[model samples]
Target: MADRAGSGTPISFRGIEKRFGGVSALSPVTLDIEPGEFLTLLGPSGSGKTTLLNIVAGLVEPSAGQLWFGEQEVTDLPARERGVGMVFQNYALMPHLSVFENIAFPLRVRKISRADIAVRVKEVLQLVGMLSLADRRPRQLSGGQQQRVSIARCLVYKPSIVLMDEPLGALDKKLRMQLQLEIKRLHEQLGFTALYVTHDQDEAMSMSDRICLMDGGRTVQISEPTELYFRPQSSFAAGFLGEANLFEATLVQQNGHAFLEGAGGLRLGPAPEGARPGSRRTALLRPENVRVLATDESAENEAIGQVSEVAFFGGDTRLTVTLPSGMSLVIRGSTGHGLVKSGRGETLRIGWCDSAVTALPEQSA
Candidate 1:
C-alpha cells in the first residue's frame, strides 16, 4: 500500500484564466488543494468547472496562470510528464482489450517489464474488487463495472493526483449512489489528492471535503458542505445548493434588532448581523427551516399564507404556501402520523427563527 500522508505534493493554481476568442471561459481564479484532500468543483453547465479540470489535466492550456505541483512549476509540462491520473465520464476502455489489458495498458506504454505489469494489474484489480472479471471485455461489463475498471486503470500507475470529470453521470441513480460510496472509501484508503467536477449538488455534498462553487466563469464561494448550506455568502450559492424562499426586501431599521419591509406591506424581523439598514437585500430561508404553526402560537418571524399545494414524499411532506403578498414559501415536515394536515386553500401560519434567514445582496429579476 502507498504511504497515505507522506505521498506527494499538493496542487496549486494561481491567477488561472482561460478565454476563447472574445469570450472568457474562466476568469482569474486561484486555489490550493491539500495533499490527500477531495475537493469538488461544483456548478452548472458552462460554469468553467470542466475547463479548469481540463487545464489541470493538460487537456487544455490556460490562457494565463501558473500551475504548481508542490514546489515544481508544471504550467508548461505535458500531460504524460505531469503524472496525473484522469477518469472520464464515459468509460473509454478499448473494446477489444480484456479488463486486465485495459488496466495494464498504462504500464505497457511505459515499457514496464511484463512480470511487473502483471503484478501491478492484479493489485489494482484487487484494490477495486474487480479481480474476478479480469477476463471480461468492456462490452461484457455493466456501467458500474466499467467505471470501476476505469478507476482501477487510473490508479494502477500510482499518480499523485486524480481528476474525475463527472465519472458517475452515466449510471442510474441507485448505481450512482453505490459507486459514490465506493469511490469515497477508495479515496480514504488510497489517500490520493483528487479534484472532481460535477453539477450535481448531492454528489458534491456527499463526497467532497470542500466545494468550489462557480457561476459565469467566476468562483462564487469555496467552503465545506455545512457552511455552504447553512451560511451561504451569496443568493446564487443558497439557491443553487438547495430549495430556498427568496424575498426582495429593504432594510427598514436597526436598533437592538433589524427590520425589513417587503412588497404588499409585509414586515419581517431583523436581518442577521452585517446586513445594513436601508440597503436593498434579499432574504433566503430554506424549506426545511420554515415551519407551519397554529394560529394562536407566536413565532419570532411569522407570516399568514394559504396552502397552495401539498406533496407527500416518503420521508417528508412539502407544502407550498402563498403569502397574502403573493410570495410563495415551501415548508418541510416529517411524514409521520400526526403530521400537520394541510391542503390547498387552507389558511396557514408560517414561521422561522431569526437565525434561519441569510440576507444577500439583491439581484435583478
Candidate 2:
C-alpha cells in the first residue's frame, strides 16, 4: 500500500506567462514544486493563482516559457496526458452515479480491468472515509461528503500530481476547517504532490508546506507559512496574510538605544537590523504579539489605547484598540488575559517586544 501510494511528482514552471489579448493574467513565474510537497497558490480574486494552476493543469497554455513534470517537458502536452488529477470547487460529481460509481469512473475511462477498478475504488473510498456511503448518490451526501467523493475519484487513478482549486470553498466555516485537516492528513498518508489554489489565507497557512503568495498577476513571495506571516518582505504580503499593525515610522537613536517613532509621537521598541537612524521605515506588528500590560509590568513598545471593539471566540478574544493618534491596532489573546476581558470604552496599555516589530524595505511598501 505504501508503494502504491507514492505517486508524488516534481514540477517546474519556468518563465510561465499568460496573456488574454492585451491583458496579462499571469506574469512570468519560475517555481519548482518538490515531490510529495503541498504548495498552495494563495491570493485574492484576479490575482492569477487560478491562471497559474490552469497552466500547470494544461487547461491554459502559457504564452511563453516551459513547464516540466519531473524531467519531462510537458509544456505542449494535453491535459489528459499530464498525469494530473483535478479536484474542483463545485464538487464535480455525477449526480446520477453512486459514490462507488463516481469514484470508479476515472478507472473505467482508462479501460482498467474490472478487478483492478474495484480494488482501486475501494482503496480510495476507504482513504477518504466514505466507504460506508459507496452506494449513496451525490445528493444524498453532505457537501463535505460529496467533496470527499470528488477527491476520492481524483485519487482512484493515482495520478502523479493532484491539483485542487479551492476545493473546500463552498462549505461552511466548520466543515471547511474539517476538510482542510482531512486533506492534509490524506496528503501525508498518500504522499501525493499537491498544488492547491485558494483565496483563503488561513487555509493556505494551515495546509501548505509553502505558500506562494500572489498579487497583481505576479508572485510576490513564496515562503513557509510562518515566515510569510511573520517576516513578510512587502507591506502587501504582511497586511494580506494576517491581521497586522502597519505604520510608517522613523528610526531614532537615543541614549545608546534605537527605537521607532511614528506619527503623533508614537514610540516603539528597537528598529529592525540594518536600519539607519533618522531613516523612515514601514513596520509591521502582528496582533498576537501585542499584549495588555499590567500595572507593574512593562514592554519595550507600549501604547495606551481605548478599546473600540471586542470579539470573543471561545478560547481567545480580539480587541480593536484606537491609539491617541487615531491609528487602530488589533490585539488577540487568550481569554484569561486582563485585556481580553476589557470591553468597549475601556482604556489599556498594550505592548509588544522589540522583536515583534519588523521593518520593511522602502520599495516594498
Best by TM-score: 2
Candidate 1 stretches greater than 4 Å from native: 1-8, 254-256, 264-269, 295-298, 337-341, 361-365
Local lDDT at 189 for model 1: 83
* C-alpha lDDT values of all predictions: 0.87, 0.90
| TM-score of every prediction relative to native | 0.92, 0.96
Q: How many residue pairs clash in each candidate?
A: 1, 0
Model 2, 1-365: lDDT tens per residue?
11233569999999999999999998899999888889999999999999999999999999999999999999999998887999999998999999999999988889999999989899988998999999999999999999999999998898879999999999999999999999999998888899999999999999999999999899999999998998899999998998888999989998997888887888866777787889888889888999998899988778999999999988889999999999999999888775556989999988898888888877764
- Tell how far residue 24 is off in model 1, in angstroms: 1.2
* TM-score result, candidate 1: 0.92
lDDT of 1 by residue, 154-202 (tens): 9999988999999999999999999999998988888889999999999
lDDT of 2: 0.90
Q: Which pairs clash in model 2?
A: none
